[model samples]
Target: MGSYGTSMAARCCVTDTRPTSNPWVVLATLLAIYIVNYADRYLITGLIGPIKAQFAIGDAMVGMLMGPAFVLLYVILGVPFARLADRTSRVQVIAAGCVLWSGATIATGMASGPISLTLARVAVGVGEAAFVAPAYSLLSDYFRPERRGLAFAILGLAAYVGQIAGQAGGPAIAAQHDWRMAFYSMGAIGLLLGFAALLLIREPRRSGSGEGTVEALPLGQLARCLVRSPAYLFMMFAFGFGVLSGVAFGYWGPELFTRAYGMDPVAVKSAFAMNFGLSGLVGMLLFGALSDRLARRSMIWPCRLSALALGAATCAILMASWAGSFGTARLAAIPAGLLGGGWSVGFMATLQYMLPPRIRAASTALFLAVTTLLGFFVGPWATGALSEMMGHDAAALRLALTLIIPFGFLSALLGWAAAGRVERDRAALHDALSIRPAAPLLARPAAEKG
Candidate 1:
């Protein structure tokens, strides 16, 4: 194995500066795009009631529209989109994706019923799929392994910003003008931002000679390498379950308040925006910084912290499930959002540290497939199904939400199990990639390797 210490030192240096590139500029531009990403993605969640009333649908149907309907295409296309990002200009890909999703979000506003709206959501998902994996790859190039937790934390905060805007603004817009206007306004904002991303964000020069040339890895080889790492497998599975819980809350929490507590959609969404969204922002920053610090002591620290956060988040969500009033739900959101935010920053940092730059985007796509498929595809639908089965009332929804909390504990256990194996798996991957001094170390083109 290449010396772990040497590789880490090299990564730290690479992260510090690209000499010609301004990473902050890249980050700022991407942040704007991500905010639009979530705003378009979750805008519907805030207006579920109006959509349902118009279509005369139940919770299960709404859940399907929000979850699997969108996620199917999102997860399915992620790998190819990531491959495109890996082989092409990531900036152009992201810019194009932003435009596609923005247009699709606008189409969502034009939908008259479930069929048209669902199709528009599918298009939105496809556009979003193109953005995230590549964006992570770009950020990995901009920041070093040690600083990645903080970097991803900062980027992850865009979700809250988007959620705050979407949840708060969507309901407000819907209240004043109608739900269609809510979609139209957010879509317009995203379309403008898409053009700005194309104009403003210059893709950084690729980092590290470890990967030699900018050649794509064969998907088979990439899969083989990942399958060999137990840590990666466990961590990915942990996130699958972990995100299931998060999606359950994020997609349905607003519904919970509106239905269970007799709160106004605007009031419920705004309160969630502040309580849960802001709490998550705090957690993302705190745990990201904390994970970075602890990682200097041991690679396992990131996993350890992730497991800890999952445990805390499970408790917080369970508390919310049982709360008797809107005020109590707000109180419960604090730790749930805080701890939930840490999971992404921690796991992303850990996973990136273990991967070669050549396949980082692909690896991220793979991870997202699992997480989004389970969390986005299954969680929301399952919650809605349970709520329907139990009686389609406030009490039933609360019970359904409570039932999802146990999976959070399962996620924590799996994350903790992966902690002991991270360093070893990281070394294994480094060795497999066959590092050399300065020159790119990964496989050259097929002809060159032959």
Candidate 2:
């Protein structure tokens, strides 16, 4: 098994040593595109109330729109798009996706009923499926491994920024005009950004074997390479479970404020946006720099730090969910926001570090597919179903979110498990890629094994 995996990794083509373009400019353009990507994706969550009222639907239906509608095609097409990126221009793939999803977002605003809305969302998913994995692959080539933690962290800001734009700005626009107008406005912005990314972002030479070489590993071999790494397996599940709680909260949090406290939707979204967004921004920068520094000593520190942060964040999420008053809930969200920001930087940095360049995009797509299917599909849908079963009240919603606490703990445990095996996996990857001498697999001293 180990030898086969090594052969598979060794099959990867060489990376280009020549610089392709300005790394900072590429980063800036990709970051801007990502902001639009996330904003378009989550805009519907902010308008859920209006959408539900217009369609005369329940929480379950809303969950269907939020989770299954978007995630189904996103996961289904992600790997194929990633494979295309592995062989073609990742920049072009991303540009096309941007245009496609932006068009879908506009279509969403024109949907006449639930069916039309769902179809539009499915289209959005198809478009979005092209972005993340390819983006990560591009970033890996543009920035060196040491700087990736910061670069990815800077990129990670899109999540919070997009969330704020979608969750807060969408509602604000809806309050001023209507829900459909929010979609139209966001979609238009995305179209312009899509063109910008196409024109401004240059694809960097991949960083493995030799210049101008692209290797297309068979799907079976790619699967074998990923599965053979225990760290990758554990890390994948850790990411999936960690994101479960976050997806649920992100989708339902504003509703919780409105239902539990009778707060206005616009005000709730804006407050949640500010509280979570600013804290998350600070946390991402702090943890990104910290992880990079600690990584100099051992890669394990980043994973350990991620686990610790996630565990603490879970506790804070529970506190926010069960808080009696709105003020208390907002206060509790501060810690959750801060700690929740750590996982992405660690996960992205470690995943890229452990894989060869040829497989990076495809592997990332697979990882996203699994995590999105598990977290994005299950999180919102389960919460909605559970809430309905418990009588669909504020208390029921709180309990439904409470059920997510165990998954958070499980994620942390899995992260720790991944941390224990990361060094070994990284060593094996290094040997496979022939970046350094191939040390005897079992000859390492016990002290250095992990």
Best by the TM-score measure: 2
Alpha-carbon RMSD of each model: 5.4, 6.2
Candidate 2: regions farther than 4 A off: 1-19, 430-450
Task: Look at candidate 2 and tell me the lDDT of residue 300.
Answer: 85
Candidate 2 lDDT over residue span 1-450, tens digit each: 123354321222122345355676777888888988888867988887899899998999888888899999999999999999999999999999998999999999999998999999999999999999999999887766767788888899888889899999999999999999999998898889888887787776777646476867788766766776789989899999988988898778778877999988788878987788778888998889998898888788788888888888888888888888889889987898899976778987889988888788999999999999888899988998888889898888888989876688899999989988887887665554453223343234333646
- Local distance difference test, each candidate: 0.83, 0.84
lDDT of residue 362 for candidate 2: 95
- How big is the positional error of residue 295 in model 2, measured in Å on the Cα after superposition? 1.2
Candidate 2, lDDT over the whole model: 0.84
Candidate 1 is scored at a TM of 0.91
State the weakest 10-residue window (summed lDDT) of model 2. 7-16
Q: Write the per-residue lDDT of candidate 1 for residues 1-450, one digit (tens) a residue.
A: 234666543444354444434666777888888998998878888888889899999999899988988899999999988988887788888988999999999999999888998999999999899899899888888777777788788888998888888888898999889999988998898889889887777666666644334787788777877887788989998989998988888888878888887878789888987899999889889988998999889879999899989988988888887788889989999988887877877888888888777777888899899989888888999999999999999889888888875788999999999998887777666666664322222333222437
Clashing pairs in 1: 209-440, 210-441, 212-440
